[model samples]
Target: MRGPLVLACLTLLGAEASAQEVVKIGHVAPLSGPQASFGKDNENGARMAVEDLNAQGVTIGGKKIKLELVAEDDAADPKQGTAAAQKLCDAKVNGVVGHLNSGTTIPAAKIYNKCGVPQVTPSATNPELTQLGYKTVFRLLANDNALGAGLANHAAKQLKLKRIAIIDDRTAYGTGIAEVFKKTALANGVEIVDQQATNDKATDFMSILTAIKGKKPDGIFFGGMGPQAGPMLRQMQQLGLGKVYLFGGDGVCTAELPKLAANVKTIENVVCAVGGAALDKRAQGVEWKKRYDAKYPGQFQIYSAYAYDATMVLVDAMKRAKSTNPAVYAAKLFDTDYEGVSAHVQFEPNGELKNPAMTLYVYRGGVRVSTN
Candidate 1:
């Protein structure tokens, strides 16, 4: 009897090890603000990824498993990002998909790492986030290094702009991108004529534009989101500075930007770069985008596809490691290569995307037109 009982217990333990369990993936992003539309689109993309995974009847460790999403609103604020991260960590979730803004993502990275939960941000492009050397942090988005060079290359090689002016919002994402663009632009022979800073909530750019216009630059590289980009473009036109190209990072790449572009036709010459595959152009993304529209219409933000991929990466890593405990999976997460809707997924030693891909986008008829 004792021998039979021992064998039964062993079998049960083995079954548990091989069976699928409910895994919860967390999401942290700004759901409301001037950037609220961006967060909404990102969340929808993340939701679509989770839904697709659940629909597929995936087998994990020889047993059926499903993905669950635990979402929180970070409001694109640093304090809120930390709070949202602590909430997800307290929930003991297996992984987190976001905290979109660099300012928010930077502060929350430490919190997620401390809790032993891995977070993959789709849109936060600041270099400092990965510089901390935390093993639990990861970013799928193209960082400042890639984006800055792409813009500088465009300005120097394409636009042949011998001189350019630069501006930033001074947040982690803004300052980092601006600095990188300035550095690479200098290396590419695009002289940095003038540099200025602004706040995220600032709507007025008259003074900055006036000062920047004084230098007579061929282009203006703005390292900030759409809120400032729209008005700045308008003011540039107001000051009769339409000839200069208005450049920015993904922060300025959103569908909602056109609403603000009404007063500035010269925004047509605007160029913004993002590190993700064009959500509007992805094959799997096509269906996902349609479904997203059906569920939540007219909201297509940048990070959504990345957020979805982030969730899928976590689940796949868990399946490969055969453990829900992040410590073991975290070790294997570095090798994550899930072919996702956005693109083939993998991470580098710093937890950044394995191969950084940058897309240069232009505003054409108030739409994001990919010019390669």
Candidate 2:
């Protein structure tokens, strides 16, 4: 009886091993530096998607497929991002789901495109990203044109601000949104009193704040991520600019924003636009956020859902084309219209999300809540 049981166990193990085929998906983000929190959140989202896909026993080409996530940290730098992209290409990942910043995504995109691996960016909202004509590149968010214009419209129509100052971190993501915002604001009859620049890693904003304060602007538009935005807010409070409305794009619209600022007054004055519908308002988003929160705990950031959706979109394309080969199924990505946690994931000819939703948010009692 013991010998028979041993033989059966060996047969089951052999069957399990023979039935599974592994597919690698690459994810890149700033897993180190000031943006580590965002990177970790994005990686967790990808990991969750891979786990869920495997649990469902996903099959491709009549073979059971096991999805694996290969995460890399670009530190939000363009060169490092390209290196990571090259590494992923060398490793022969079937698809990719990240490089969170536009600065990183745009450069890394060329590498992925050169290698014929499909790359989907979950965040990176620069309009130029899609304009690069890379057939393998797709974005799952509204571009800077949408976010910047939306914020400018809200500022002009609702807030009725006359004079505005702008500050950017000078990265591709930062300068791109600032340029759009400036253009939109100027067209809307708002005066551009001052323009300033800062690096993403800079903590000292007093020099720029002092100049902007001298200009007596009614509002300040910051083009950067939450790490810079947080400290900038604190410095604004110190410089007596707390009452002035602080506006930014999706870069600053994180749950971590208020905590980073630690100045409830300054945070309360912040209005940021995110390139997606508010999770609480969408039925699918609400349910998805619940599951995400359950698994990730208090680590929910803006792009996690997008990252999850991007991963799903890649897998969906593979399933539809019935192949995991990047070249074989990448074209199928163009025809996708899957209902994801974020939205109906469809793309235009330029690889931009079709009818992408944009939402404005503000801090209400120290919590970042959507105003849209």
lDDT of candidate 1 over 275-333, digit per residue (tens):
96776567887876777678877777677778778878888888898777888888888
Model 2 misplaced regions, further than 4 Å? 1-9
Error of 2 at 335 (Å): 0.7
- Tens-place lDDT per residue, model 2, 102-174, is 9999999999999999999999999998898999999998999999999999999899999999999999999
What's the TM-score of every candidate structure?
A: 0.90, 0.97
> Using lDDT as the measure, which candidate wins?
2
In model 2, how large is the Cα lDDT of residue 187? Answer: 97
TM-score of 2: 0.97
